[model samples]
Target: MVCRVSGILLAVASAAAVGGCGGEGGPTSPPPPGPPPPPPGPTIGASLNLRPGEVHVLSERDAIRAFEIQGAAEGREYQVIVMSASLSEGRTTPLRVRARADDVSPNVVPNARTNRSGRDAAIPPARGLAGELRPDRDWHLRQMIETERELRRLRARPAEGIGRASRGLAAAVSDVPRVGDTLTVRSAIVPGGGVQCTANTPIKSTVRTVGEHFIIVEDDRLAGRFTEEDYADLDRELDEFIAPVSHEYFGEPDDLDGNQRVIAFFTGEVNRLSEPESGSVVIGFHWIGNLFERENCPASNEAEIVWLIGPDPDAEFGIEIGVDFVKRVARSLVAHEYQHLLNASQRLGGQRGQDTWGNADLWINEGLSHVAEEVTGFYRQGLRVRGNYGYTELIAGDPDLVAFRDFFEGNLENAREYLSATTEFNPLALNNNTLDFATRGWGYVFVRWFGDRYGPAGPGGIVAGSGEAALYRELAVGGPGYLFGYENFLRAAEVVAGETTTWGDVLAEHFAASAADDAHEALPDGAQFSTWNWPRLWEELRTAGVRGLTGGDPLRRRIIQMGAGVSSTDEFDLGSSTARYYHLRAAGGHPSMIVETTIASGGNVPNSAEARIIVVRTR
Candidate 1:
């Protein structure tokens, strides 16, 4: 049954569940055969619809110190305590959350009673909403809560090795078809792909060939999109362009002989086939489920490489350019995915395994992949560096004057909107879309910097090991007994730079003073030095003693503390009709990069008329 609340149908979990939200009185209806998917869930907190720089603050008297939301079925709603209160006002920054497709009723399936068993039975107790029950609440609620708790707890724990996210992933591999054979399987990463589907009801697929180095499979529908020539061209391109790049950086293919080849799967309408935001055109993932015990995934073989393909020039994915753009995107996708395949290859002992999945910060993994794109040099033949490099640099570097004209002339909302727009354009979030490029653009810059300064493995040597261990190993800590862990990259930079100076000192000398800064610059040309038009920002950077440096920096060069020399928090204000961006390194007990935007004199700002603050942590 569906309880209508606020004109929206609400499907409650189980009656025994606690903390569930209740509907104001409404009518009930039967659940439909298949429900429309839910919007993406909140990341690390409740759905506050907060802007990037906005913060959610709670007073000290609140009971829940921390809580996480576990989004389950489309219709079912589970009650979860998002966060607890602290004595001091707690600040929470905005985070983007990805919708999950693995939220079906967990216990109903065979051996699905626990995460290892394909069920999430070990999570803390959660309550069901007070509304009509679409599906039995207990199983779905249990699955959702347990899965979330497990994932979160896993994130909190140290990184082990890359592995499957659940026992179900083992099934994903077992469902694989041998070369020259046809088989059907459920779509896990794709949209409209049922979560609870079995062999009887699966996406039709076939493995046409298992070459010495690659196994090719195609969705029945996707195969129809390409002609024989198209398939041949695609195969040749992968063999010639993509595989070679992967081998060069990540070491040789696991097996050069035909005995064990990587498995590549292609699908059509990839954007529509799965939750739109979560599904990309090309994907290569190693199942690392934190909730369940380690299980063998790519079941047919532990080393099998899984590839999910997307459209050739898919407009839905913002690729509205042209065939050249599409082909360029496709090549990058192949290279990026193949690198992931290599990163997770156990045969190479490349620091990938079940535990390493999601554990390696995006900066490291995506940065390396971006480096892979440039293995042949950005401008050289066979490499389409212009698109990736140019766009990302434009976004990373100085803000475009045209884009901010309205905001500069208008009010605070306009400024926020403009800033948000720029952030969305760049991914690796570290540098606008740097976070989105999945850590591609600026990340590539970091890898390049580290490699040039340190050596081949350079920092990669640490990344090739466990995540937490690697981080602490390089970061210095002031302790009498500690042998490992530097306080930060600063101390480590001293060793790498062979000097007493900090990374900040070196960056200023290289970027602002030298000509090479043009080629090695991570931000725009004018953003550094005195060229930046925003006087307030320039002053803040100089006063903060952080000039030209931005979050995109691997060392997090600029530090902004309240009473530190960098101007008071009050200076963050730039009067009404003003927009300013400041990058300050996290200091003292707080180890995070703080990005604060000031809106002193604008009527458009929804928050306090005085100013607003949002802190970005450099993980």
Candidate 2:
């Protein structure tokens, strides 16, 4: 039977099922197949297009704020993405997302009965692990991030020792301290709470191997043992692959230690800072203070240094670092932390006064470092083979994705967490005083998206700087004033997108892409992610779903799948700088959708709630 509800037509089995947009339009339908494979559906109503950053402000008198999204008037298919983010500079407010049919009939899907919220917002249940993650690990991570932030915030300078060192001390060519030689290097008197110490940390260290770019040093008092061959292999990986890759994308490192080579100092103190037994552990680190003059910290080594958790053959420090650990993760550490080393050097080297590297612009720095991790993996796999990134193996259900995942796994894991992270935290809207793992995760996601969009074109696919790296390089060098979050993007964006682009437009599209990642079109000029094949990658992650980070399927991200019926989420608080997503779609019954976003049970939204509703069609 054909019935008309509120002016839209619906094909229903019976007139009794008829209901308004406020009620369940009809009955229930089977859960859709899931993403990575979005089946086509019937064409519904009129084709509607909206300008980017379209704002639909809810008034104090309005009961509910609703927008109508209809299908194409012709043959093209599409979906809808609705994003609600708090514009408040610093606050979290309540938000509710819902969808239902109104002008159309109830019997949308021929066999199925109801409407669907459209995507999955839930994750899989938990799986217990032998080792539980520790809370202090996050504390330690935040500590290190804050320490670097302060150094940059303070606009620190090269140590007095570094600037006034004797000719031989600062020289880059002499081999006064060759391989097998020992030296007493001044190290940090490490402490908690981002504190800087003037004295109290130094260790006797022996050089194991020397590469073109870095010298591998092990503490003489270290417990972890290694062979000459292992040291040689470490030297090769650092000098040949890691060093070259880090240099190419991020620029250069300041030559410290008087040998034209930075020091990869492996020490047990790093281990001492980590969890005693299992959980989130700090394996390695690079202190920004190393670049300053001795007066900055009388004990400043004044050398380009990256510190790693030296090996512990015995479970002496509650964690064991074996030869296998060195072979796998320790090398990867070079790939990760080296970016921090270079970023600080290039940004602060010649000194642009205090305006430059001092800001630390957390998100971009972390994002670029993470990108460095994945890009190096891509380089190792062979220049830039687009689809070659974990596709075939992931789809084939290959258990071991050894090669690429090694470099990119942290990115995928953290991104999953970011999507499932607490609503109170927004990646871009971060606090200078605090930091989190998932926030770091979003940094990776954003940078990856930025590269795919703004990065120069590559050979196989849109690689991160195939010939000459553009925005990524610009971001590292930064502008005259570098603030955290979007401001950094705004400045660098002009380098590629020209002047007129605004933050509202970027935020809207980012939220839109966060939801409707598939249909790159249907969106305005700025809404697109040309690089990654997310669905395929998502499908691969269905199994080894992160236990603690994402208890359910990480793919669930922000998708709220309301079947062929009316659907709504429990009122959730929307935090500043954070975005909340709701996806809606009609059933087989070719009907128009009415998506309502409002305060669940309120008189009206607050005036200070600088709210912007960005809707995009993702067919």
After the best TM-score superposition of candidate 1, give how far the Cα of residue 216 lies from its true spot, in angstroms. Answer: 2.7
- Per-residue lDDT tens digits for candidate 1, residues 479-513, read 12222211233454454444465432333222221
Best by TM-score: 2
- Model 2 lDDT, full chain set: 0.56
When summed lDDT is taken over every stretch of 10 residues in candidate 1, the lowest stretch is: 126-135
Candidate 2 per-residue lDDT over residues 1-619, each given as its tens digit: 1121232444534233443444565555544543452332222222234332332222212213445454333322233433334444557666555555444342232222212222233543222111232223254345556655655555455543334553222343354457867766676645532335354376888888878888888888772477788789888877767777777677788764556788888887676665564455566767777776555455566678887777777856556756555456666677778888888776656463444554345666777887777777766655452342334443243255444345755666667656655454555455644465566577787777766665544542223334335666667777555444566677777775455465655656665556555554445434545445565456545544533433333433334342334444445666655665555443343445555555645324454555566555454
Per-candidate clash tally: 56, 30
Model 1 misplacement above 4 A: 1-180, 183-186, 190-202, 208-212, 252-259, 273-303, 312-328, 346-360, 376-441, 455-516, 519-570, 573-619
